[model samples]
Target: MNTRILIILALIIAGIAGWFFQQQGKISPPVNIEASEVDYEATDIKAVQTNEQGETEYELNAESLTHNPVTNQDEMSGITMNWEPSDEQRYRIEAGSAAINQQTGELHLSGGFTLVSEDKVSENKTAATDIEPIQVTGQTLKGNTKSRQVYSNEPVKVVQGMNRFEASSMKANLETGEYEFGKVAVTFTPVERQNKALF
Candidate 1:
C-alpha cells in the first residue's frame, strides 16, 4: 500500500482531540487553588463524548488526572482513548502522560504514545482477522484541538502489514488527511508472485 494511504491512521488519531475538546468544556474549571497548586484530582478517570445522533465519537480513560486552576490545564497519566469516526473504522490511542489546556485547546503528549487503526467488524466478516491494522508510535507529540493539527519533532514510526516507515519529524492535519514529514525512510515487503502453469 502506498504510504499516502496510511495517512488515515494519523488523521483518525488526530481526531482524538476533537472529541476531547467536548469533555474539556464540560469539566468545571478549578477554583480557590494557589497558582502553584492543583485544585482538583481524580484517579481511574473515564470520559466519553457522543455526537448529536447519540453515537459515541470517542472515549477517554486515564489512571490519574489533576487540574491546575491558574493555567486551566488538566494533566493526566496512563491515558488511553478510543475514537470512532464512522462505522467502518476505529482508532485506539495510548499515551504515558499528557497535558491539555482546556481554555487554549493546546495539547502536549509525552512519555511516548501509540495509535492503532483498524477496520470495524461486521456480520459478514471479522475485520481484525481479515485486515491488517496500522500502528503509529512516537516519543512526543503536540497539537491543538481547535486547530485540528498534530505534530511530532521526535522520530516517529508507522507499520502496517509488512510495510514500515520512519521519519525524523511529522506534521499532519486532522481534518484533511494530509501529512508532511522530514527525512523519511520506508521499507516495503516484496510481493510474491504465484507461478502460473502455461497452457
Candidate 2:
C-alpha cells in the first residue's frame, strides 16, 4: 500500500530517537555503568534535535527517564514528542511509557500511543491555508532506529483529513517508503463532492 505520509511519520520518530540515543551520554556526567545496575536517572527531561541548518527538527519531553546498564535500555514515562521535518508540517506523539534499547537501536512504545499530524504554514512570505490534521492511534509501536523499520501487531487506525483507515496490524519501511497492512478497512469522504451537492 502507498503510505508516504506514514513512512515519513515513522521515520521522524526513529531518526530523532536515534539522535537522542547517541547524545544520551552528554545529557549527564559520566557514570560507571555496571551490569544489572542503574546507569542514570533523570526527571523533567526536555530535549531538542536540530538539523545541519540549525533548524529544530524534533523536540521531546518526559516526566522521568531511567537507564539500565545491563540491558542497555532506557525507559521513560509520560513521554511527549514533536517532530517537524519542514516548515509545512508537524507531528506530535504521546505515550505513557516507552523503552529504547541502546545496543539494538530498538524502540518500543506502549500505554496509549497517539500520533497527530498537522499542517503548518511559515510566517515569513508564505500563504496561509487550513487543512484538517491527521491522527494515528494504536496500542503499541515498535521501531528500529538503525533499520528505519516500524511495525505494530495490535489494531491500528489512521485518519487523514476526512478519510479513515483501520487495520489489524501494520508494518512499514521508512527507508523505502513501503507499507504493509493486514485486514485493512478504508473509508474515504468526498468533502468536495458534498460541498458541490453531488451526493
Candidate 3:
C-alpha cells in the first residue's frame, strides 16, 4: 500500500508537470516590429506656357504650382502644351520643373510628355537642338521647344523683364505675340532706389 501511494503521487505530479509544459508550449511569443505601412499620392499638378522670348505667358489648370521668390525658381506639374512660332526672329527655349534654375536657365520636366511645334519655321529651328530635352525633377513639368509657343490654359505666373504677374488663368496668343492675364492682381519687386526712398 505504501508503494502504491507513492506511485500514485508520482503519477499525479508527472501529469501536472506535463500539463504545465503543454500550456507553456501553447503560449505565443510577443511579436517585435519597427515599421508600419505608408501610403503616398501625387498632388498639385499644373500646366504652363511661354513665348519664344522666354516669357511665361499662360497656364492651364494652374493649381499646386509654387515659385520661390528668393530663388526665382518656378515649378509646375501635370502639363499640356501648344506652341506656334512666328516667321521672323527664330527662337529656342528650354523648360521643365526639373530644368528650372533662376541662375542656370535649365527647365526640368517629368511625367513623360512631348514638346511639339506647329510652325514650319519653328520646326526647322528646333531640329537643330533635337527639340530641347525636357528635364524632370520628381514628376514636375518643364522645357520649351523651339518652333512652338508654349500654351497652357491653367493659372499662370509671368516674369516679363522687370514685371512679375500672376493670374487666376491665362492665354497666350503666340501668333499675335500677346498674352492676356485673367482678372488678377500682379506683383513686382520694387526698384532698389524706390525702396530706399520709402525707407
Candidate 4:
C-alpha cells in the first residue's frame, strides 16, 4: 500500500472530534456554565455519519459522557472512534478523555490517545506484513471541524512495522493526507527484535 494511503489514517482519526460535536445540534451557550450539572449523560453513545454516497464515514462511541457547564462542552471518557475514509484502510482511536463543543464541533482531547491504521484482518497471516499497520499516539490533540484540521503541540509518536517515530508536534490536514511533524526522530527496529515488539 502507498505510504500516503496509510497516512490517511491520521486524517480520519483526527476527524472524530468534528463528528462528536456534529452529533449534538443547536446547543445554546449557557451562562454560569460552571454551575451547570450534568444536563445529559449516557453510558454508551454511538453517533454515525454517512456521506452523500450513503457510505458510513465515521462512527464515534463513548463509554460515558457528561454535560459540563463551566467548560460548556461534553465531557467524555473511554472514547473509541472509527473512521473509514475509503474501503481499503480503517482508522481507529482509543482516547482517555475529550471535551467537545456541542455547538461548533470543536474537540480537544487529553490524557492520552492512540490512533491505529489497519486493514481488515484476513484469514491469511502471510499478507499481514504486506501492509503494515501504522500507529500514532499523543498526550493531547485538538480538532476543528470548520477548518478540517487536527493537531497536537505536545510530543507525538508514530509507529509502523519495524520503525518508530517521535516528534515534538504533529499537524495533519483532514481534507488531505498531508502531515507535518516537528523535530522528528525515527528509529528502525532490528528484525530480530521486531517480532517480539510488534503486536
Give the top-scoring candidate (lDDT). 1
lDDT of 3 at 97: 32
Question: For this target, which candidate reaches the highest TM-score against the unseen true structure?
Answer: 1
Scored against the true structure, residue 102 in model 4 reaches a CA lDDT of: 56
Model 4: per-residue lDDT, tens digit, 1-199?
8889778877787698678878786567754534347677888888886766987877889988888776689889989878665545467877999888857868788879987776655465435446677788999889864455678999999887877889999987654545789999876555564345554
Query: Candidate 2, 167: how far from true, in Å?
Result: 0.9
lDDT of 3 by residue, 55-76 (tens): 6543444234566555565555
Sorted on lDDT, best first, the list reads 1, 2, 4, 3
* Local distance difference test, each candidate: 0.80, 0.78, 0.46, 0.77
* Model 4, runs deviating above 4 Å: 1-35, 51-54, 69-72, 85-89, 120-129, 145-147, 188-199
Q: Write the per-residue lDDT of candidate 1 for residues 1-199, one digit (tens) a residue.
A: 8787689877887799788887778856656654558889999999886766998877889999999887788999999978665566577878999898866768888999986775677577754466677677999989875565778999999887877899899886654545687899987566798899989
- For model 1, what is the alpha-carbon lDDT of residue 93? 76
Q: TM-score for model 1?
A: 0.65
Error of 3 at 87 (Å): 1.9
By TM-score, highest first, what's the ranking? 1, 4, 2, 3
Kindly indicate the candidate among 2 and 3 with the higher TM-score: 2
